[model samples]
Target: MSTPHDRHLLVVGAGLAGLRAVEGARAAGWAGRITIVGDEPHAPYDRPPLSKAVLAADEPPPVPALRSEEVLETLQVRHLPGVRAEALDTERRMVTTTSGELGYDALIIATGSAATTVPELSGVRGVHVLRRYDDALAVREAMARSREVVIVGAGFIGSEIASAARARGIGVTIVEASERPLERAVGPAAAVRLMQLHADAGVRLLTATTVSGVRSTDVGVDKVELSTGETLAADAVVLGIGARPATAWLRDSGVELDARSGGVLCDSRLATSAPGVWAAGDIACVDGVRSEHWTAAGEQGRVAGANAAGADAGGATEVFAAVPFAWSSWHGHRIQVVGETTAAGEEDHGDGFVLYRRRGAAVGAVGINSPGPMARLRRALTAQTNP
Candidate 1:
């Protein structure tokens, strides 16, 4: 191991969580050599806008860099853009990348996730998955030229893509396998309201349906066949089914990973099974739970970074226990869900907010275009979880 004077901190996957991990290390008083690696050449950028503002913009927007080169320079962070981590060797504390081998005193795995794709539509033109910056640009260009867009899955990403397509005056059809859109996300009561919002927006909602096959020409897709013995005309298709954590590189790294999700398994302190290693963001499965939201990723990154630094310095590590929170916008209406809305008793106010209770006490909430109630409910949930 390197001495304290020559200690180094290496961060893989230069996304939101990776950027925050660097910052968190500095905030925790880590003065070691810091290096961040990213498979993408561009700097870290916000992803939520890719489905919303980026697609709806008349002109292509600039790359939404989360941090400037100057900021990274000020932090003394050496960023290795476009360098993919190929493998890891926890025994030697070395990471094999596309460029060269990297040794670190402490390592943070923040690879985040990649968009899940349809197997049948593989290598077909006009099929898109919005996870990277390039994917969003390609989809935006496809939306501009297409007349009708078929989005698979009615989750938050799919709904936002539908809203963006409609904003461009393009016809949208959302094919969801679930009976109700967002049924598992915001629960049944709130999901009904969300479905109404989509219907009011004039987007076609095809529930209990699955894409069976696609008819593609030499140039692009022209039609989509559903499982219900129905086919829909489409010039473009967007797959928003879900995302898998980017953890294939860690399979043989001696790091414990969740078998189902392929996420790195960590404790409350974000420490991995391997020594001198920690995981955060989407790739982190903390106590058997993995959160894919943006807020959770950033929060986990901060905590993991501090803990990794503390491990190097023999300092006290902090626990990462917080109420889950996520927010999304669909057709100009805000949808916010906080805490565990799945198992709690829901109280629909019929206004715009639904409160979730357990044992006569508030535990969570889902707000539809109601920020005031969401704010209050989130505060209450935070207090409840903390106390």
Candidate 2:
């Protein structure tokens, strides 16, 4: 029989979730070999700042490391950077990667998500998507040389990028396909208020619009064409329409994945359909919901890691029931949301706070520049769920 030290815990993806999984394993009394594999060349780093601070800084800032090298060393984690997981053999407990095949006793999948791109924008020099460190660097560099930027989405990522571009004194135009920006995320009323922030900041908000095509010059893109038969001059174009979970490699690995979102389907305990495996972060679809927030990623990572360790040690696994929360900063305004924002009924408090209710109970809330109200609502929601 394999001893405790003989077992190996392999974590795929080296983002916040993946790093936390390593720490979670250690905290859960997992005294075994641990290895983290990442396709990015750099070590695990914080991604939240890539759209804000990283893009706004005049000089390139060092990628924000999630954990110091010393910390990872103390954790005794073998990190394989620039290694991509190609396939998985759940039966054999082996994973095929760009470097080589790695065997593990327990596995945690936190591959996260990748930015969706426009098909026609392929190979366009001035087109960009911000997901990785390199992508941020490239966008920052492009923003410096560009006069006007066209953002193709009105989501958090696009809004943040627009904020960064405006901070650099570059002209920004946001083309959102929906009738109102963030209508689905924060409700129509709150989304309108949020949209006003862009307008106040001198950003041209084009609602119910889509980018049909692009006009490129020899150097790069020169103009962006809209579906409304409008053409706007653009030096740089950022595609922030959406992101899909990075679970393509798990398709044939005997793992159950959501057909719509391409996310790995997991149970309440974060356990995947395949035995000896678990999923977390943006790729984990539990109860038909996949949270892409940073907080959820860390929280789910810890739970999944602990559960994986428990399975290896024949211990009881913990259930993942953390409340959902997410925050975003746009145009110097802080927007916070907690719990399920899709509740049936909503009450606008008229003070930048919107409370969502289901069956006359507080289920979620969205606060704009109102931290105190948001905190109270969050606590109330937490208490409601816990009780």
Candidate 3:
């Protein structure tokens, strides 16, 4: 192992993945000088709560810090915030940022993704997208003053926003382009239940619909134009259409990227094509698949950091292979999913049963609600060595 004297690790992006990368490097016994660069001004914070707790909260909840102040103090990292990485110079082992250039012995990228928005709604007032704390605050402010809210997507984010809007007695109408909401993620069985849950909660869900355009008044957006030729009055419009990986800065960086996801192409170990470079989080597509789940990002970061640190010290390194898992909350029910439930699977039990979703010979995924089933499947999945 190299002595603590001749090492410097630089992490780009300050999300969960980037934060974990620094922590993982430390845990792997690296005494290098660690530096974290992020475009955002704030420190690392949890994002999942932005769509749920922040929207329906009676009192504005405290900022959700993923790495607490106490935790940050322990990490002992040098943070350069509000500085966007402009380019990467792999040959020189330097990153060109908006502020200046940063050099590194090893690098980890976890730039995450950007919230997708409609170009047609560009420059229109009251059109919002939620992907950051500031976005959540803006949406919360808009929701507080709005009556009719048009959510232009039916994915988990849109559905969660609808639930929160309904909780505040605001009229919510979700316009989904797919034939059924969450058709790609959960298939028809679970999708139907989620649909019913939304209907029961007094939220209007429109499927197989697209927003052709928006009609805005001088003050703000007042209506949403639909491809179905029906225009609905809206006090505000929230775009939850989706997101794209934040890979624009790496376009000319000579790093291999997946055209489909626009994410950094990495091997099973989360190492990119460039030597001494690794990627994690939504920015990384490992083994031809990019996982958008929070847990997967953290795991990938851990592996990337460990490998980067170990390689610098000529020590041991580990591969990352965490089972994909995600959880969603809506209308007071907890929805937990493991692996790829959409894959062809055999049902071990009837509908609403847990510990099912057996694909080929292995249990590919499990969807559960209650504590018992979720606990069992979580433990089983966690113990597995591979995805």
Q: Give per-model TM-scores.
A: 0.97, 0.97, 0.94
Flag clash pairs in model 3: none
How far residue 124's Cα lies from its native spot in candidate 2, in Å, is: 0.8
- Cα error, residue 190 of model 3, in Å, equals 1.4
Best by lDDT: 2
lDDT accuracy of residue 2 in candidate 2: 24
Q: What lDDT score belongs to each candidate, Candidate 1 first?
A: 0.89, 0.90, 0.83
Model 1 Cα shift for residue 227 (angstroms) = 1.2
> Over 4 Å off in model 1, which ranges?
1-3
Instruction: Write the candidate numbers in order of decreasing lDDT.
Output: 2, 1, 3
TM-score of model 3 (CA atoms): 0.94
Across 1-387, the per-residue lDDT of candidate 1 in tens digits comes to: 122657899999888889888888888888889999999988878888888888987888888888887898888899999999999999999999999999998999999998898887877888889998888998999998888989999999999999999888889999999887777787788888888898999999999999998888876779999999999999899999999999999988899999999999999999999999999899999999998888988888888888888878888898888788898888899989888887668889999888888898888888988899888888887886678
Error of 1 at 118 (Å): 1.4
Root-mean-square deviation (CA) per prediction:
1.8, 1.6, 2.0
Instruction: Give a tens-digit lDDT track for model 2, residues 199-218.
Output: 99999989899999988887
lDDT (10s digit) by residue, model 3, range 46-81: 889999989977766777888777888898888898
